[model samples]
Target: MGAVDRYLQEQHIDRYAFLPFSACRILQPHKLRNCGEVKTVLLLLTPYYDGDAADRNLSLYAVPRDYHLFFRELFAGLREAFALDHPGASFHAFADSSPIDEVDAAAKAGLGLFGDNRMLIEERYGPFVFIGEVLTDADIPCESGEVRECEHCGRCACSHEVCLSSLTQKKGELSGEEKAALRNHPLVWGCDDCLLACPHAKNVEKTPIPFFKTDKQYRLTHEMLENMDEEAFSSRAYSWRKRETVLRNLSLHGE
Candidate 1:
């Protein structure tokens, strides 16, 4: 492995698998061979904590700036920077999405430890973080090491409760079982019980940059959605999903 690749592997990729919450994935040289040769995986960290995020109107990811837009520009800059030095290879960026398992890739990258709740927890933000990856055809370095395990800590009781995001995503009236989960659930939007439960969340140092700070917190309130158009609503970290989905989630609260 080259020096650049070695440094990233030891520092970031190495922690991918260990974190209870992280985005873990590998770029297939073969996959990129078709494109350019699959070189480096550009990794990014987005902090979603604001010191106070409970009983919020939106999911944890939603309250912040739309990461999809934020990171696209970020990764593009990285590629441009790398291209200046190593113009021999090409790259691709992905903040990924709900449909893909980003946390799992973080684990594989050795960037953090994994919790039983299936989230990747880092030493700084715990599991309340967003990740982006850039797959490249240039050979750099890889963090193939395994992450330390954090599966059985049982320290945080958030995941055990019914999750609000799950309920809301269902897009309809919740069943008695689902409602029970919500009453006992830790959050109304994205799940944070597991995040709050992690030991590393409280005292981590803040990033020097301001872009990583999320929206602080924003719930999918009825008034906000009812009054605004989809274009406006889509601007938030909250994905531009349909209004009915959020409405059903709010219904669980009977408000």
Candidate 2:
């Protein structure tokens, strides 16, 4: 387990913690069925916020390429290396589609605190990070840290029901109230209002990860989307919602 920690640090993983499988809040047990009696979970945090964009029409998180693809490639190499070191152990990596409750597990591992906006707020990265995990059958010894609460600054008081980010991703026709809320919304894909309002999020350091800083698309115009093929679009984080959803949001923004 100590060697594993050193290796992960060398790989430039921002933060990591080892958690027992029993301590994790499993949401999708079937996803881990083939892992063969998971014993320990390695939680990792990868910060993705490069910087704020002045001409941004998309969420800060959506400006870069999809993190899901990055995690897939990363975990693949890690699994191969760990297999060489641990002869009979099994390791499986998961990100957004993880079986366990990622935020809860991360908090319990002493990685960060729960923000009022329902996001994991790491002290250094605020909420601008992606959580990933590696499940292994090895009984790695580790300490389960206490979960702490973030400062209730009331900045993220808005509920999910009225969240602009959630509203922008809705399919089909939006109601008059929804349309009105989005009329002057700067983001066509997601919102960053809560993050911007939070004091902990202020003056945060930009991501050191090179992947997030390269090939960024801060603003997405209709012409750009019109010319993009499926492959090009799929590379973006906002592409999961497809072109229709974004286009609809843009239209509502009076683009």
Candidate 3:
């Protein structure tokens, strides 16, 4: 274990990989270069709340509080704390809000394999883990080894055109054809068709994080949104786009 591994272990993070910052620059050049003297990049995978059959209506990712905020809190003061142990180095942390292509970073770091649906698939957490990173000026060890390639088994059953995750977030009212498709679908917020179709998604270990294990919901209902105050709405990932977007989706779903 190196400095990066020690830091992650102390923070209770079990899944991570370290890569040269240069590799992260290649995948998302426009987004990752501005963090200042980033020499090594650490890719961290944190699991989110993944509900079982009762919560099938919601996407696995949204089952927890906004992961962007979750990671920011988890890595709070990490750079300064790390600097205390090693001089002349700076660290910065970012989650999904950053420009880095997290899935690509994780894939390249050998943290997970890329599924046909473009989701990074980990053996333990499947595609439900959130990817975060610590960018550092330190020369952290990077013997993460090769990227694990997916078998490309052509097993993903849902096509993007009809993917409910995209369809529910469509800007305006659903088209006549789209409305016909939603008639039988139970979700108004997001879909997990691809995940449910994945062979690897089955029999994965449940997330061990306390925050993810409790206090989660499987669906975003109009009633739930209507009842929330400003603070409650503001804190959630689902509400970042605002209430109207969800209302629009709910209406389209005939809720």
Give the best candidate by lDDT: 2
CA lDDT, candidate 1, residue 243? 70
Per-residue lDDT of model 2, residues 1-255, tens digit only: 544655666667758888998898889988977888999998999888998768889899888899898888778777866776666888889999989999989999999997777788888888898999999998888867777888898977764458798888888889998888888677898888887788888777778777788889899888788899999999998888889988888777666
How do these models rank on lDDT, best leading?
2, 3, 1
TM-score of each: 0.73, 0.92, 0.87
1-255: candidate 3 lDDT, tens digit per residue: 545457666666799777887676354556655667787887889877455757455567767666776677778755655676558777777787665677777888888897888889998888778888878788877754555767887777676567777776666666788876665667766787877688888788888776676557676777887998998777676776678877877666655
Ranking 2 against 3 by lDDT, winner: 2
* C-alpha lDDT of residue 237 in model 2: 89
Find the 10 residues in a row with the least total lDDT in model 1. Answer: 13-22
| Least accurate 10 contiguous residues by lDDT in model 2 | 1-10
* Cα lDDT, model 1, residue 137: 61
Alpha carbon deviation, residue 35, candidate 1 (Å): 4.4
Question: What lDDT, from 0 to 1, does candidate 1 have?
Answer: 0.57
Model 3: number of backbone collisions: 0
Instruction: List the lowest-lDDT window of 10 residues for candidate 3.
Output: 24-33
lDDT of 1 by residue, 1-255 (tens): 544345334333232222211233433334333445444455555655554544565556666667677666665565656576568666656675422356665656666777776777777767766777665666654554564668576776553444556665666566788877775544445665566567766686554335445444455556665786767667665445567766655556554
Off by over 4 Å in 1: 1-36, 53-55, 98-101, 108-110, 156-163, 183-186, 206-208, 212-216
State the C-alpha lDDT per candidate: 0.57, 0.84, 0.73
Question: For every model in order, what is the number of clashing pairs?
Answer: 53, 0, 0
